[model samples]
Target: MPTHTDQVPETPRRRPPLGPEHRWVILGVGVAAQASFSAMFSGIPVTAITMRADYGLSTGELGLVLGCTALGVAASDIVWGLLTDRFGDRRILLTGLISTGALLVLMSLAVVPTGDGRPPMPLLAAGLLLAGVLGGSVNGSSGRAVMTWFREGQRGLAMSIRQTAIPVGGAVGVALLPWLAASHGFRPVYAVLAAFCLVTAVATWKWLHEPDDAPQGGGGTAGEPVRERSPLRSREVWRLALASALLSVPQMAVLTFAAIFLHDAEHAGAVAGPLVVLVGQLGGGAARVWSGRYTDRHGNRRGYFRTVGALSGVVIACAAGLTLAGAPVLLTASALAAGGVLANAWHGVAYTEIATMAGARRAGAALGLEGTTLFTVGFVVPLAIPVLLEQSSWSVVWAVAALAPLLGVPLAPGRRP
Candidate 1:
């Protein structure tokens, strides 16, 4: 994948017609927002070990803990989208960062031992609910802010950069959290992430600003104020959502279980677990940026979606075979690296399509539905994987996983409905 600088057009160097200076402020704040949300998602890999020990949970239950966050994220995404349209982007973004950070700190505290050795389910559930509601808004709100700042052509690059925050933040957690858990325990991990979130929130509150005027071609009138479009009413919106949901099945399954498969199925080590997670996420992050540029060049994002989906199925099948055959560690790692690259590369392309089809006014709502559907499927599928593994084999699980992305084939060729 080309770096951000390499992807620029060779037409000519030019200045903006908007009569403004560089938008460095917007970019800086955008990175912070992405980082905060990244922290939220990234905490998963770090917390997995602590969660297993504290809750006395199995591998599937551990997957459920993270998956449950998706349920909240999916539910809140639409609500936040409606709120962003109604109240404006600044308010929504700030609320999301600050509130989500607070809830994360609370989640850390809730899981702390309370005199006795027993875990606190009610407190944790309440905290998780709050975290979900606020943390989930990070998805819709950040995109809304980006749409406000960037032009149509600029959006693919901008959102791809923003998407990098997910894995980058997760990578940070993966790199840090395990070591943190190994040495200091989970409370320190929570404290560190919460601190990062609060700092980003403060930065966002001080620096972030929405454009006073709306742009052209974004589902708004030239003179009239911007209005949020209803995603539920749009057929194209749901088709995009369906495609994304199916795409997520493999993506989520792989990420959720890759570490366990490496540790349990492959007998690698504590070291290999996070190494695979980091490698996959890093590859995924790069793929997102590259695919975004590719889609913009091609003009048919649905086509890119199907192609990546099909190829990802093949890559994952090879990884599954290696796992079944007990292939060498290097071979398994190679398959994982290749598969991870293909698996998550389509995210930005799919999202760019949503933002374009829905337009700015409706982009938040459309993405809200899209994220909800995708993560809702993500949350459910992994929870079932343990059951599937118990009854059948990983081969069956992989075969079923391979089939989910095929659902996109029909959607890709059809018209935007």
Candidate 2:
């Protein structure tokens, strides 16, 4: 269950998370809050042109700078998860969002290059890493909020909606931040990203609250009839977490390489590459919501994940084969789009299943563990892709990537009731 603070006297405790009466409002707040952070996490990469220019970073250095955020996220998720368990989701959300915004403001004032002098590469990289560490709170906190506030039938839908906020915020960031960076400067880009966090923080403060049934002092199992399953020790939890991480590998493969591969192979980076990205992100967002709602009614999240994993493997393998055979670019793009959507489609479903297995009380740690594993892979995939490409052909690299999702299919446990 979600909780706001310890020793709540009267005032803040009255507000809801806000229970069934205003749960949708809580969801809206969650989406907006998540989107704000997602924009920074996903959008910053798109500002590479201006960032590289201002910082005078080499291509390799730029990769490290970018990788730093993912590293921080991987490093801190479990810590945040543990904190979320001790505190509550709202407290963590408010603290994390506000601190994130504050750090960005600091970056605008101190870190970004000004008047022809550049900040140290280490400083810039460290700032991004710290931002990731602060912002990473959203994953477990927001998810735990859903697990507490919503019951099973709607939890899948709710979780997926929350999940889509990442891409929605990201798409907005990608669309806007690059232009802002080019036109105004990094100060304004930092300011705008900070604005997203601050604005969402306000929403979170006003709307996010403890559910009516939450434990008074804290959330985890204080008043329960039985002690909840601790996800940290559960074999099922580890298996599902591992499965989720494995499937994400193929999604990362498509996300990181589709554009570069298309550019090199078909010189279609101008149109087809972006088209594939747009298709994957947008379509993946829709597919996630749709699948979540579908499975909510069907009661088969594990089964759903298994099917999607197999299909993701098949579709991506086809895309790789088409590229290798020098087939029509349209067919390859279509295949990539399908593969990306399928690969991403199961995130909410898998997270819901994992959280469900762990129970609401332990949801934070379970989700945190899952995010840590996925992000660790996320950090590794981008770096590994280039190395694998240099050592082997594109066909070999993509063929290897396709196997990841297939390998993940068996890792999900049987459907939970």
Candidate 3:
């Protein structure tokens, strides 16, 4: 055997003791970073109407541009995760945000439509794709920062709050981007998003950091933690990632097409359908925060994750049934939106468990895996909905969506997790 002194221990160097307020500040930076990215990620689609008009894009071209961002994100997630694992959260996040911002600024100058001319479609696609590849860094790296800063018991709450960035940034983006594109131009729209990214990058550089008190290998564990392996090799990580993807199908359906289904198919009042979609966004955000806190207090992350999926399956099935049976528009809209709240709520809990089980050391890769699958689902659901609509009815699409969460329930991790 090698001498004891020859066997150097590998661990994260101990951090200095941080003031409690600092952790919250770090969390805020994470939220801001994620929100800015989310604004660019999910918000791009909201400007679809103006984008199609400005770029003079056909239907197929519209879909291509819309999907490019997600495709780039999905393609780059694992690479960013690996880099986060190697370099740590601060470097990766700072680098990602700054580069992504610079890219968007460039796109605003070159790729967006001018008064008389639009850039080639492929050039626009490539720029958006690169923006996504860079922004993908935010998901895992910021998540890893939270994993390092927050204690195990508080991770659920922290991550849920971080997850809120999606709707928060999305709300801001959808509210502004369409109007900006319509009134000023696509250049202003892209420039504004770039401004958000650059602002968040400045804040992140200033305040975000590893706790001085944090142990290097990972945070949130005490005294001689269990040996960890690559997240790719862990069955538990795989299951959670897969389950996250499956559960996302229904949520994506509601998010992607709730308005169309309610307005076009059900013939609801114009405002009523979009109104329900807004309610779903608000309710889902509230539910995510509440569920995170509940699980953190009760120590029931796995149970909550699985139970929510099952309940969502039932709720979505009810909505599908109602749609098929020709239920009144009011009733169907209410059911679908309710189902959305539950479907969206599990994200924080599932992400918490995935990071916890994989150990904070490998949290980046595990969370990266989750991000990959979820974005892939987000990408695929929109494409699939059109085909499903062609094959059958809106009711049939709802039926397919209802099945997603139920299938996810069975893949919930082992009991101890």
Local accuracy by lDDT, each model: 0.71, 0.81, 0.81
TM-score: the better of candidates 2 and 3:
2
Pairs that collide, model 2: none
Q: Which ten residues in a row have the lowest lDDT in candidate 2?
A: 220-229
TM-score of candidate 3 relative to the true fold: 0.88
lDDT, candidate 3, 101-203, per-residue tens: 9999998888878866888889988988899889999999998888877887788999999887776676677566766877888888789889999999899
Question: For residues 119-189, what per-residue lDDT tens digits would candidate 2 score against the true structure?
Answer: 99999999989998999898899888877778778999999998888767776876777678878888888
RMSD of each candidate? 10.0, 5.7, 6.8
Q: Residue 115 in candidate 3 has what lDDT? A: 68
Least lDDT summed over 10 consecutive residues: which range in candidate 1? 14-23
- TM-score per prediction, in order, is 0.87, 0.89, 0.88
Clashes in each model (backbone N, CA, C under 3 Å)? 0, 0, 5
